[model samples]
Target chain A: MLAPLLAVLGACSQSDESITEQTKSAVTQTTTVTADGPPRLEDGSVNLGPPPGSMGFWTANNGRLVNDPNNYEAARREMNSRVNIEDAPLQPWTLALTNYRQDTFIASEPYTRCKPAGGPRQIMSPYGFEIVQMPEMERVYILTVSNAMSYRTIYMDGREHPAEILRPTYLGHSIGHWEGDTLVIDTVGFSERSWTNRDGLPTTDKLHLTERLTRSSLNDMDYTFTIDDPGAYTAPWTSGFGVEWNADQEVFEYMCQENNISPAAMVGEGRLSIIVP
Target chain B: MKKQYIQCRLITVTAVLAAFYAPYVLAHHPVSAKFDTTQSVTLTGRVTEVDWANPHTHIFMSVEDKSGAVKNWAIELESPIELEWGGWRPDTLAIGAVITVEGPLARNGTGQIWANSIIKEDGNSVFDLPDNILESQLGSRVEGPAPRWPDGHPRLGSEPGQSGYWSVPSQHSLVESGVSVAMDKHGILANIEDAASVAPFQDWARDLYVIRQQNFMKDDPLFLYCIPPGGPRMFQVPYGVQFLEQPIHQRVTVLMGGGNSNWRLIHLDGREQIGQVTGNDNNPLFFGRGLGRWEGDSFVVDSNGFNESFWFSNGGLPHTSQLHLIERFTRVDLNTLQYEVTIDDPGAYTREWKSAWTLLWVANKDLPDHYCQDNRP
Candidate 1:
């Protein structure tokens, strides 16, 4: 029995490795198109032209748009401070200490390990995001390309949140309303098991997030988020970003268990590994 | 205190009784209640036509009762592949061949009979009887049950590395128990030291081996035609397989993922002999004869006489008329079954090879009632 079982696993694992290699090759082939002499927008933001004859476009962070590259840190700091943290908690897990620890920062390991970064905070990562809308259901699904794919469904039915309070999940409960061309969303009830960033900033279950999504152009969309959680922050903070649409790519099913590497490492270190070989 | 204790005991008894009777009511509700299992129906009919296809073959017959009322009845038979290997064919019955069939009626209360066996007007059984059938008629010959080491338990010839038991606690996940090991890169039997000692292959059988090797992963015509590869091939497909046990009738229905379709009904009717056969065409279709019986605590089945058109494994193992399979299925516990299959076909293998695996009980869930004809794809 063990012989045949090993044979099947061996076949599937080989397929997983080939798929990963294919993804890497595809990434390398992706051409980065430059901005066609920045064009100004009505909101005072500059628009970079279409990417390499592709319909999708890109925009730099507002403060980072200046000529001096040395002030990148300052620009990033300003952008980080502007993030709305009114309802967003610092960290969801009780194990996370309020003070940041250098040892806890696992560097690039967090994203590669397929760990959930929580909801709205995950949407802020530098990676490209896509929004899939189902008109009949009045819902929108947001997909990200990090090792972990996070999805959030924004309900637009004008119904109140469950009165008894519901359990927190990674995506959280999102309710939305459309104001003219902008879609305003209120989200709460997130689980404390996620990280706020790849650096391991944590969040709590009481985290509340407000987001404004507006399709400012045919190929681009603007996103703004306000976070509020008294347990983790002193005051509310706001952050905004923009995303470009890619019509060619579609979401595929991702099963983390196939040829997982991170769990193997944990098992080697005597951690409780849930995956059975 | 005494009064309260009496009330608690009564509640416990009621709960236990409900749990025991629930499955009985569920199985019989609306459908099973419509048919009488004990009422055996014998029908004499002319073979009007035969649909020699997978899932099961249907023999369209026009029968006349004592009142001379002509009624059309559909007699379900084993696959043509099975029938052909068993020395039967679609044209064996012809258009006007008179035959008698004895079996249970369909649950739909229609004029259909699940033909147990077909008998000729001259009282000759068209199906090959185990005792009188020659090796040629039986097709491939595989080894029967054999004893194993360590407590002298019989070895189940499943592919190595399969898992799961019959009965698992409710908390266990079926996925964990249903793991199947990948075959060796050189194929399952590559490492056998005595491969030369395996059964010798015939010309057509050797051609099948080459075909299977070249087109293992390629989409075959059977899949495109939407035909459910019956029996063992269905179980070994990449998709999941589940067994639904109707304990009241001591019957088990096996469902597989291939085609998301078809099943085997294991009737524990205490009969050992193979049934009669009747067909309307000269050549049999695929998925040959199957006869099951109980050996000690295990259910042993013999299936042979299959067509070579279908691949044996998803990895493209092939077989011919010489493909004889002896499968033993034993419920290890309330939720797990130890499945052992022995492949003996001189036409395909150099020698006899065996594989063993375990099938987990479907747990508290009911097997999805999926019909292939209804599938959108």
Candidate 2:
């Protein structure tokens, strides 16, 4: 019995050291900010939840998928990006729609109308969010505190996306797995109504996203995603940003549909602002 | 051979580790984390105000301490639903009525106490629970030990290798636990006169309920906005409910398969309830915040903080933010989940009331893919 227990402990110790080294390397490469090392699960996986007595949720102010220096200053202020839109490989029609959406100040955004925030927009809209990993049921829930108080379930137990989704939903179907300390999520089958980005980035029915989430430190989480859609962009593109961990905060109730006056009011200033009257 | 041996050893070690944590997990009762149950206090005072609302009903009392200084103490009790079932009326303790309350004090050191019992100046209990109050059992009791987790706690979710959900409750409408009122599958009363029997509603709430029944619920917010069936209405809906329990996470997710794919979370961990505001600055919710604990085989959930957008239950029952709910989910057998709820909303109902019902566990099937949007008018 002692021998078996020693062997199991040895295996876990090696895995723990590997995760620590990899996390250190990634943090050192990105920024000089020292990490207070995040809490770990029994198996050495970074525990995204509140560590023991402390409680918190992840907060991301900028949900921008791309960094376009030439874009309007207002848009730049809201989005912290890793890749420039010029290198995002946007198609002609998609680029035109994105420009139009930016020009109109995103007034007609469906999310403001209390629609569900789909795809990457789930992580982008930021009041606070929690990644609840329930291994017992082989499910991980990403609960967002804002927008429609939306939540998405990612199947962690080796299950493929359904071959046919009768009705595409706002959240779509997601499957996730662990690569060392990073939680890699692959999602597909999203509704066409919701945008993938707050800047009105459009997505077709063919949108496939591979997102990576890593709790790099107690105070920081690295979120990156690669978008692949034949109907929207010329080629697959990747971009990312860091989400801050908000201590002593939990996901609160946010009823978006209650007395929402945006849909009726957002008329884009009668289109004269764009036509230059 | 070495790989297989390592795999065998790994299972043995995992089992041992799991055993070590089982006792501690089972012994945890963080349910009353909001209040310090150890410290007990008894106070006698005159009622100043009765804030009859959803999440909780706070009875403010003016008590003169030893120094002869009158201080207002907020006495908290079960939600309006539970209080109604306990025979508490909206005017049970009117303004300036002298009463004594005994309960534990709040941990926050505020002048607040979670009332255990209340007595009037006449030495009578304020709660007047009816003798007829009983569990509404259905489909014959299946006598069998319910499935349990390794930690010895009853399992609310599906048993291993089986997929099932709670559906097709015994009672379809929200009638008083003992009152036998006739209503359709949609909670439309066969005789509008029976509206008085459904629940002890305030004059205005009963009037609104009658108007809704008269118009055949054409103005139902659930139908108009595709809103979630909040409160006890989640069970009254068509497709039933599913329990996703994550003991490690110290929470349970109750998913409603009937109305717009809605779900509510109940935290089993001992965390103090806090204020909630949406990013858009909206307060209050349809499901409200829930804190739960396991009392033997029964899982008791205390929920509060509801908004008035949707009905508390079917038949157009109204509620306010002051609505408080105490719901009990007990898995009596492999195929039965007993659900009991106490509604204490002084804003809508004249007294606190309760409704008890049981839901059958539909085995070897998933929740039907039903959404209000798909069948909305």
Candidate 3:
């Protein structure tokens, strides 16, 4: 499998490729740490989270759940909990990835090229997103296991959004409702080439959003988000966190365009330079 | 009559926008980074060119090696609307028509073949059946009268000679109306030409299926991305499946027309396979982990985890996530259903092999919305 671990990691790292800022700050301090607690529910039904069929897997440290498989490094701190957005609120000649091309890879983020990382960069990656919950076709799907195998049906049956001449995708056009078990959603027709998350943030084609989600203890998930857009924000912003739930985590089929050498070695502006082929 | 209902609603909106700009409706790849699903090779010779098209369907052929050299290969298949709904016709491979192929090989060494089956010259394999019992030309179409359902099942469609005829609407229940070519699902319409019986691979899966078909199956993630069809290629695709049968909820819902508008949930309980009632920790599905029952009027089904990211067949043929599957369906009268499938997959293949086809009975119809990147093929 993987040729003797790439001949033992190609003989334990040949030229560490300029050490890319000490391996992304040592994989961003093992990716955001913070797992302590605050999400409780063991079938108590006292309300939220663990109740909606919780088996496991959710991040942003909402209530802790990398499900301890020898601590996959504590689910890389809720999938590297987004840090530098260079003070967002932008909208005055936008490009901002620390002020554009400031070290190449075209200021990264566009999922380094596998494309469509879309809104909240798929609720901030590490590959998790899956809500299902079909309440008899009122619809709720979601399904974002990494590069999102294109899902997010949502419609909740009340119907009322399809008009704007349709086509503007990359996970936009969602529409949910329910207020008791919480669930909100509301997305708008997006596709300004979709972006967000590691703040390589750009978005347009009027990208309005809403999200909400709720559930709190069986594993967690408080998720929030707001982000309206007068064309890439100058106002309307709010964000969110907490989504833990890991019952064993099954989305592994990363196929990120197989071995994308991320446009051949250029780790200064955003990242991706592993060349295993 | 109101201007003929606006000319039949403008011919049903011009046949639903000509099926979303139909250009062979696309997407479907994966030979594993170009071939090496445990390697493979067989080749026979002569068709020379087929193309066919729509997401995939190549052909080519030439073979000859051992030093005599003369390669030529190519192969591929599936699409041309799932090989014309399984019965195949576009002359059914004929330039010179010799055929044979086996599959895998490529990882750049290149002759080419994401193939896996094909033996024709009447030895029959594709839409097969030359043996496996052949007799009954219309006698007692299973005696007649069937339409049940108070949970007694039966009632599915097209059963004159027990629902397996096809002057045309294929997926192959039995065809031949003057070479419409079909009958392979163990119904054996062999027709004439020979050679097809391979499926025993595993030398490490024939060298990883030729390094994933010489490096172009690009690691094959659901054929480079239009993912959704779970085993028994979701009833041999020809896009027309619908069976809801809930039986109070023991579970049985299968509604796959192809990619983007999918639905598979078949848990009929007896539990030999079932998981993902709640998601997390990966249940690896592209239609595996099914589990149905009912054998008398026939329903069967089985499935397994499945997630090598696609290709149990379309000739990209690799398998590993262990790959199990049994399937069976049998409507046998009132518009036929038949099916069958086996493929045990000892990690890749060195044993188990069986395949069958047939579906018809579309009746009334209502499934449409395909999506595939809006028309990617």
**Top-lDDT candidate index:** 2
List residue ranges in candidate 2 displaced over 4 A.
Answer: A1-36, A73-75, A261-277, B1-145, B160-164, B258-263, B270-282, B362-377
- lDDT of each residue in A99-196, candidate 3, tens digit only: 45322323454454445444466665554654554443345555454442444566766777767522455566777886755678888877655456
- lDDT, residue B263, model 3: 58
Full ranking by lDDT: 2, 3, 1
Q: How would you encode candidate 2's per-residue C-alpha lDDT over B209-233 as one tens digit per residue? A: 8988766565566644556678888
Is 1 or 2 the stronger prediction by TM-score? 2
TM-score of every model versus the real structure: 0.34, 0.67, 0.26
On the 0 to 100 scale, the lDDT of residue B63 in model 2 is: 74
Reported per model, the fraction of native interface contacts reproduced equals 0.00, 0.08, 0.00
TM-score, predicted candidate 3 vs. hidden true structure: 0.26
Which one wins on DockQ?
Answer: 2
Reference-based lDDT, residue A184, model 2: 96
Model 1 alpha-carbon drift over 4 Å, by segment: A1-101, A107-111, A124-127, A247-257, A261-264, A267-270, A273-277, B1-377
User: What tens-digit string does per-residue lDDT give for candidate 1 at B1-377?
Assistant: 01011100011101111211111111101111223334456666676766554334567667654565566667765434345445676567766667777655655567666555678779976643232121122222233343232433332222122211121111111011233333322222322332222224455654554454334223343332334454455544322354433333333344443342333445444534332121012222244455566676677877665556555543345666677777787755443457667788787666666665555443222222222221111
